[model samples]
Target chain A: MTARRFLSDLSLTVCGLAVLVFLLLPVLVVAPMSFSDAKSLEFPPPGFSLRWYQSLFGSDIWVEAGINSLVLATISSTIALVCGTLAAYVLTRGAFRGRRLLEANFMAPMIVPAIITAVAHYIAFARLGILGTFHGLVLGHTILAVPYVVLIMQAAIRGFDIRIEQVAATLGASRLTILARVVLPNLWPSAAAAWIFAFVLSFDEVVVTLFISGAHLTIPKRMFAELIIQVNPTITAVATLLIAFNLLALAVLLLVSRRGRLFERGY
Target chain B: MTLPGSYESGPVASQTVAAAHDVAAEATAVPARRRASLRQWELFFLLLPMLLLIVLIFDLPILNAAYWSISDPKTGALTLGHFRDFLDSTAYLRIIWRTFFLSLEVTAATILLGYPLAYWATKLPPRWRIVVLGLVVTTFWVSILVRTYAWIVILGSAGLINRLLMWAGVVSRPIEFLYNEFGILVGMTNVLLPFLVLPLFAAMMRVDMRLLQVAETLGASRFRIFWQVFFPLTLPTLAASAILVFILSLGFYITPAVLGGGRVPLVANMMDLLINRFARWETAAVVSVVLMVVTLSLYAVYQWLREKNA
Candidate 1:
């Protein structure tokens, strides 16, 4: 019985370790391949070089796409933050009928599949004659980003003490003033986390952007297009940078939320 | 008490009754009633901009798609031609069926792999548990496209796996692992694994350790204790995440497009082709509505399971 138990435990550990490797395989493989000297997708590289990184930097299209991705993510995430934060505050604090229904409406963009959103946006934007416009792209990305912001901010607001708002109101502050001052200032850490979440979401969005973005290029969109056509070593460099960027964002979020214990308070 | 000759008392008696009513209102629910209305208005104004944006951008487009699916695009006449086109075509049905089965396969794969990993994590020391789960989340944060792209390197003809196999003489030639159903399955299972693992791990942690201890003390074998107690407790979460993975897989665009190399066009890729490649807006709208309905229905079930577990 003892020997049998030992065997089972060993096998379970081995299986668990194997699955972890599988989960991390892409990240493990892609980062090293970016530094490979050989042109092909060779593992245990014959030699190490930074050629792919150099090529990625040298390419004008890549540089342009990077700028576009940054701008698009920044603008959309900011818009989502503003609109979603106010909506979240209302949804959490307001005594109103149909609040649940309205909250669902805000979250619908997230629950509905992205491909459906892509097709819907494609047809609607085409009919409105804004299919290829940057404004249309922003709108599409913002809709996707809004739900995350709403989710995060709603949780944060719910975690906040309502008595504080009542105290501010008792001090003769207007509703908007209390929200702008007492409420939002205390919720900045979560708001920042939500913004970063939305930013990463927009930065990585592909399906909707593919459908509606006529001439505009973002990193994921470009990488997707290139991937479907061919594999390039330069893509590994871009992928590595994206991995680093996302990890950095995640680290900042963890640090910010840890200091605030934003998640621990039910977020 | 009733006022005497109130009907005939004219303005004097009426003023007295009004004053009584005002005093009663002030003594009772009037302040709260007024505050509730005021708060509602504030909330309304706060919620308005987001409502308008969602209605105009998100809801309107979806409603527009539904309209397009059922109406004549050029003349705006109500017709069933688009949906009929979808229903009558075997090609569309074939792709839909293929998407269903592939999503099922991916869901099953994730559950099989994820269940063990989550279970194992539950048995680990706290520090190591965090390390293992952290790796899973870090992978989750990586781009789906980047992860999908990585598979081509690992599974391509001259890729890592093939090279390793050739070196060991495991096979005489490279097995074709790209641009097919097998490749799609592998890429998708890898991409969606974290979704299942994270939630399952949390649920596993929530399973009571005392129940296992009790079973063990009662002379339940290790296998019996786990199978009867621990696994059953975590089943709801496992089932919930499996549905989520299924729902996500049904609409997968990137994996099938890049890894499948257009050979196995899932519903998403098919929609992409209908709209972008062929400019068949009405047909794409029909496909969208169908996929949306299927996904939402499954999501409702997923939510129910989650609520049940909670």
Candidate 2:
């Protein structure tokens, strides 16, 4: 490379690294600060302690909220996975009129702002008298999460070949039998990724949860409430833990998807 | 389940009418023999649970919100007065405007900062490229709540920057970095950066470096080649991420609330105020309708642009 080109490349690399530093800044501060012995927000702690983690795990509200989030995410994402995968299968495999329109309608929830959905739930759940109920949250989150499931499965189905199912049909296998024995096995990896995607999306959701859920707290709602209610160090500790949890999840996903080569084409 | 003629009656009776109507109408044009193979009924059964979930959970409830926006409390009659009330309020109008501009600013910032980083990753060796891209993708899995909390720990008055500044004797007192417009932007941009980068990185991978080589051979300066060739190639992804980030940022409630210290009232916060605090469902619904229209229309534009470009 020429001197001028080398100089320009050096400057670009420096600037890029600076941006990466900026990206890493939050995680750096939050993780270490969680280990601080200070009762409040302090940096470069005079001493270290596990008080915040103890607080996070020891508190009933935090534990309950965590459990609430897990249960809701589990139920909703499972519903979304089954419903959305079926929808995608039909959209991709079945010859039908207005298929494009159906696909668009299915994809709509992903783009629609969450607040609108939240307000919608606020009204519907109130009327159903399921407001603050776990089932109500499951209903709302399932709606929010289905679009992701459908979109992911749609991509997966488009890449898939239907010859196996056709061959199975020619062999006198029933449609249900073919679907169970052929199509689903072919789609399992995508299905797994989509399930995890839906689960994580629903887990991270807050705006709609705030509206539909009252008294019952999810992790995000609790964290949001805590941040607004008081700037607590425990929240930082909680955030650190959540970050660690998410990183672990991402690693697991990367491992699974790499083995399956699921995201080789572009997410 | 037996024949194409038996298409209408199902659990997802809502969309079934529309699909069955289409099928029947098309069936008349075709011969009875081909119609026997019609799978619209099977399709209907396949799509039933999903259709029902969407209708009952998402579609109906939103329609209800829209209904509550106009229904009069006394006689339960629909009216346009609620919309007028929303339009008449200058405070609400300003909040909406501020929300738009804040989102615009954040989106612009993300693009400006993220483009270079994404482009740089493309220039890196394959080994380094994976590392950088891995960092960017991993950031996505982190929840917004956790990221925002991280921002608080960093930006707090007694936090990292302030303490460092004080220790360096840069100032007598700590800067009030948290609970301001500046903090809100920093926190939002941090959380939103990964979104902008991943898309751009994906787009950048498709960029043909041979074109740049061709430009280099054709006597184009490096700056000229990048500005005239490389930049334009990536513009579509830039546009896509920009619109996406802006729309997502517009609906943001947590980061701005915690960082803005309730000082900056975005539309979502205002929506919260109207519905939760003041119990003004009509006004909140009107705001939601407005938000939905704007968000969806922009998304429509995004889809159209992608298709047009495609």
Candidate 3:
């Protein structure tokens, strides 16, 4: 490369690396703090220990909340996946009236603020006498997550060939049979992507969970409550574990979908 | 007209024609059955879950919030006292202005920082592009609470930046980075950077490389080509990201609460304080309504701009 081009490239690399560091620094800061031996939050701590993590694991409240979060996320993601995938199929494949309106309604949750949704759900569930229940939180989260699933599944379905299904219909196969055998097989990657996206949305959800989940405490809510009371490192330990889980999940997803061209397919 | 063939034919022939008509009717009815069944199943299985959710959670709650906002507590009379209080109080109005300006500032900062990073990412090879994009999005996976705490550490009085500055003899004392507007801005920008970057990157990636090359072939300078061609195409993405970041920033609670240390109160914080601390659900409801209005207006503005540009 010419000197000018080389200099420009070097500058770009430096800037890119700087941005990366800026993004990573906050996350990296918590790792050391989580391991701090001191009671208060101290950087470059006097010593390192696993006391905070141990404490987090030993606490019943923390354990229960963690379990609650996992179960809620699992159930909600499943609901979102099923509903979103079906809607995606109908919207993408079927030539139906009001399809645009249905599609827009499905995605409305995403554009609305989570807090508003939460408050709305809180009031509605209260009137229905389901407020503060796990079922309520699950229902709310499923709604929040459906938009993501629909978006991902819609993208996946767009790449599918309608002619394949048509061919199946011509060859003595029922439409249901074609959908079961041909369409869903090709939809696996999108389904998996939707599931993962839903999982993350539920797992990280806080604003809505705060209002709707009256007595129930999901992990994020627990962490927020703890933060308000004190600057606890146990929360940090939870965050550290959550961050690790995210990375591991992302890694596994990347591995499994290696041949799927996920980003190119618009999930 | 049909009587000639019927009368000439045997009883068996007539029976065969009847059976053929029956078979044809069955074939026609079968497809109708299948179509109806599929439609019924789609409505029940595919659409019902989301529809029920929207009705019970989304539709009802919004209506209730509006109702709660208007209902009067004293004498069980309907009144607009909550909104009156919100509009009447200087403190509340100031809080509203503060929240608006803070969101605007954070959005501005994110655009300024994120655009260059996104532009740079587009220049890299595809593999590297994915890696960079992943890195940017991975930040999203990290909880906002943790990100805020990280900022506190970095911007705290005896924190990383201050300590480094002090050690480097750049300052004599630790600066007040926390519990102020600057601290909130720093934290908010850090959290919102990815929102700006992703959309901007999406737009920048769509720019035709050949266009820039052609400009270069025609003896246009790199800066001139970028200014005249590339920048104009990226404006819509910039506007979209700005709207997104601003709306997200408007609903922000945790970051400002932690970093501002109660000095900077956004609308979300006001809602919390009113509901939790003051036992003023009416007031909280009013604030929530106002916030919804603000967010919706911003979204409307974005749509309008997009339509006009189109």
Q: For each candidate, what's the DockQ?
A: 0.38, 0.39, 0.30
Rank ordering of all candidates by lDDT, starting from the highest: 1, 2, 3
Model 2, range B1-310, lDDT digits (tens) per residue?
Answer: 0000101122443344444554445434545344336445666877999999989888898899989888885677999999998889899999989888889999989998899899898888977887887777667678888878877777788878888899999988989988887898998998889878877887788888899999999999999998999899989978987888898998888889888878889899999988789988888889988999889888887777666655
In candidate 3, what are the lDDT values of residues B1-310, reduced to their tens digit? 0000000223653454455554444444446666656655654565676677666667667778788889886664778888888899999999989998999999998987798799888888888888788788778777787788787667777678887888899999999998999999989999989888876787787788899899999999777898998999899878977998999998888888888888888888877777557867678778778888888889878768666644
- Model 1 misplaced stretches (Cα beyond 4 Å): A259-267, B1-31
Between candidates 1 and 2, the lDDT winner: 1
**Model 3 lDDT at residue B135:** 81
lDDT of 2: 0.81
TM, every model: 0.93, 0.91, 0.87
* Top DockQ model: 2
Question: Looking at model 2 chain B, which ten-residue stretch has the lowest summed lDDT?
Answer: B1-10
The candidates' interface RMSDs, in order, read 14.9, 10.2, 15.3
Error of 1 at B144 (Å): 0.5
Which candidate gets the maximum TM-score versus the true structure?
A: 1
The TM-score of candidate 1's chain A against the true chain A comes to 0.96
| Residue B208, candidate 2: alpha-carbon lDDT | 89
| lDDT per residue (tens digit) for residues A1-267 in model 2 | 499999999999998998888887777777888888998787877679999999899999999999998999999999999999899888888776798988888887778888888988897888889988888989889998898888777776776555544445545565557667867776676677788778888988989999988888899999898889888888878888888878776656555444323223363
Better of 1 and 2 by DockQ: 2
